[model samples]
Target: MNRLRFAPIPAGLPATVPFTGPETLERRSGAPFRARLGANENGFGPSPRAIRAMADAAAGVWKYGDPDNHDLRHALATHHGIAPENIMLGEGIDGLLGLLVRLTVSPGDRVVTSDGAYPTFNYHVAGFGGQLVKVPYRDDAEDPDALIRAADEVGARLVYLANPDNPMGSWHPGHRIRAMLDNLPEPGLLVLDEAYAEFAPDDAIPRIDPNDDRAIRFRTFSKAYGMAGARIGYAIGPAELIAGFDRIRNHFGINRIAQAGALAALQDQDWLNHIRAEVAAARARIAEIADENGLTALPSATNFVAIDCRRDGAFARALLDALAVRGIFARMPGVAPMDRCIRVSCGPAEELDAFAGALPAALRAIL
Candidate 1:
């Protein structure tokens, strides 16, 4: 047998996964997780209208989705008060991010991000042969000033920022972000990932111009709309930048059902508000749980809460492992300091109850 040739870039890259899904863990343990709180999924579920839309669209699976994503984009435009031309739909924020990297990053081009930020963005940058320059998080939040300085120093083509951040679940005010954008080095594009925007405080999101060429914002149905399984998301930016995605994106990657479901989801703001209130209550409950367990819960602007174990990363990892052993799945930041906390997503009462019941025993086993 003859071996196939590999590209030098890909050959040099290590094979790695950004996340180990609960299903994989379930398979490994030979048991299902009693509480699926590891992933930041909206376990409260989607709007009834969205469910019906998906079910209705199912019969049309024989046909490919609109390559242009016309209806969904137009709907989203109306929802955000932006022109349809400013929107570009993709499989998810993950897919759109890859396209953005492809569109901007050349081999060895620099990209800037927080060291403990979203790994998926880093994965995409690596996949595209971009040199990633990381800055440590400041006070458990993404430091805009530090990020801008790093990007300027490294002459970065892109700088990634996640508002209402994952893992640690900390965030900065919108005015701070606006200041960062104003000072960003010329030619460096800001990739503002607002995947959890629906869960954030109103003041947390900056009022950047949708047509701003200096930045592009990524949003997803996965978080608030409970459409993670649909793999539907979109990017909003200047019309010119948005059009660039058409060159490299999978034209028909978004399925018809997902498109239909997303449209319906956008039209149902009442459901989104309901989910917000429920998530707020759940966050409070999670804080109470952490307090009862002798831990501190970091203030979160997202669907998840990061509980500080008053120990080191090792202790948090042990606690997470123990929780898994107890059939409760949770996750922690991959790096130090931040890893002193385990991240838990908001869900319905029963799931939280499962997590609550498992916490004490896990703590005893670990401590």
Candidate 2:
């Protein structure tokens, strides 16, 4: 008789997850946070049209989603001025990253990313048994030269970079990215994450050839559309590269209701513009609050503001803990230099008021 064996999972499994959601913070604290300002999510919520569409599709929730993501893909294609064949919808950028890794990376392959950049990409690479070579950020932005050098040095199969980066919120102009695109090596995929492109300034998003196979750009309804919970994101690239995703992706992973909502949301361009204005105002207010507290808030093209803590990671972490205890959910950077700051997401006026009210006490408690 064979006894139940307790062998462990493979050692290649990542020791840590890419990032923790704000729900985990609430669970750990054993209390609901008053101001949910972490996670860089748009607290403004999704378009009213999207909500109505989701509500209308509620009865169909039991049905499986379209495997081809047909309606949504066509709508996205129209939105991006590309053919449907050039677009591939995924559960979210997270799920897409996993599938991309599976499609391109083999065990022991090399991947390149910016040091202290998005952790989710690293998480996917590690899960696929790929070695990650990280390049340090230059002036708080992903350095194109350094990334190209690292990719060349390691003979990387893929390189990941988030324009208008997380934590730092700095971005390179679109023209700069276009110039660097020509330098990228062959047989290597550039995973350009443009999750925050809507928030970035004009000329910050490059216009690449829709048929460009050397790079694939990722966009999500999660950020500016304020539908992070909906988990809808799409990748735009060469039809062949985009088509390759179907071989390994969970075809029905994007839910029926989510697809309906995303379709409506895409059609509501006025609402998106309104939210963009709201986000800009919130960013200004956050910078004001930071200045009032004698802290320097970094200029941001993303929804959140990163406030330099004036000390080290220890101080930034202590401030984060204090803010959390004071019912304000905030997060800090995970590495040195950059880690000396705390990140706070833009929210409604009341939530910002809560953060402003808690600032002094939290600082005192931490210091």
Candidate 3:
């Protein structure tokens, strides 16, 4: 019997997801996590206004979301002081990245990123048959110089960087990022993932020309805005590059509720400021907890903290597993020496108390 055939590209790809959701873990363990802190989601949740917006929009579920995402895109443009033509909305940064990889990468095309950077981006590159070139992180931060050099050396079509980076919770200042972009080789597009930009300092976020075609910056409502479940994000780039996303993106991928929630969330700057303060306090509390456990918490600009277990990756993994068994869900980086640290997201007092209480026992168990 003949079997259905897949395209050569997809047929050769591995069946894998970049992340295993917390719900999947709970199912496998046959228990709920006492503190859900592993996924970097905003446990604080979106603003009451955003919540109300979603509820108000729920009645319109019978109608599809605006395929053009006109209102949200225009709102985002106004928020960023750019023209609507310079923005493109998608399900999330993850979804937008896939579309970007699709638009720019072809079979055997070269792409560059820091080793152990955002794995989802790498996954997309691999799925599209793009050759990935990885530069090692320098001192736990993405080495911009090395990345630029690698892109030039490989004649890469795209390069990826995340400011206030994930897993390790490190960051590069805005000017340095600008220098990296300036030095990027001709024909290479910089994919700057600023999903955590809201949590970063103003100086760390570079000012880019809205009409500049050298880079495309991706932002999401998922992090500081507390709209991860809504699956709404947008990209900022030159009009020409932004227009390319429409060619391949899922036209109606963003639902009405998501668009409403995101729009409402964007309008609530006061709420965003409140969340920022809350996250800052939570980070401090996490650091204090780490100190109590004789661990060092790295300084973070994002909503999560990476606590150095002060040992090898094996030790960190053992401790992370011990915490999981105790019903406190947390995560560690997938690669070393970053893996020597365990990452915990900022949460309210109650959720963090669960972590603070479980950590000592988890460490003792690992020892």
Writing each residue's lDDT as its tens digit, candidate 3 over 1-367 gives 2488788999898888788888998998999999989989999999999999999999999999999999888888888999999999998999999999999999999999988899999999999999999999888888999999999999999999999899778899999999988899988999999999999999999999978889999999999999999999989999998899888888978889999999999999999999999999999999999999999999999999999988999999899889999898899988888888999999988999999999999999989
Candidate 2 TM-score over all chains jointly: 0.96
Model 3 misplacement above 4 A: none
Task: Give the alpha-carbon lDDT of every model.
Answer: 0.93, 0.88, 0.93
In candidate 1, what are the lDDT values of residues 1-367, reduced to their tens digit?
Answer: 2377678888777888999999999999999998999989999999999999999999998999999999889989988999999999999999999999999999999999999999999999999899999999989998899999999999999999999898788888999889988999988999999999999999999999999889999999999999999999999999999998888888988899999999999999999999999999999999999999999999998999999998999999999999999999899999877999999999999999999999999999988
Tens-digit per-residue lDDT, 1-367, candidate 2:
2465433334547467666777888899899889999988889888999999999999989999999989989989888889999999998898888889989999889999988998888888888788899999887778989998888888889989899898798899988788668878866778999999999997899999879878899999899998998999999989998989988888778989999999999999899898899999999999999999999999899999999878999999999889988899988888888998999999999999999999989998877
lDDT of 2 at 106: 91
lDDT of 3 at 348: 84
The candidate that achieves the highest lDDT relative to the unseen native structure = 1
Q: How many backbone clashes does candidate 2 have?
A: 0
Reference-based TM-score of each model: 0.99, 0.96, 0.98
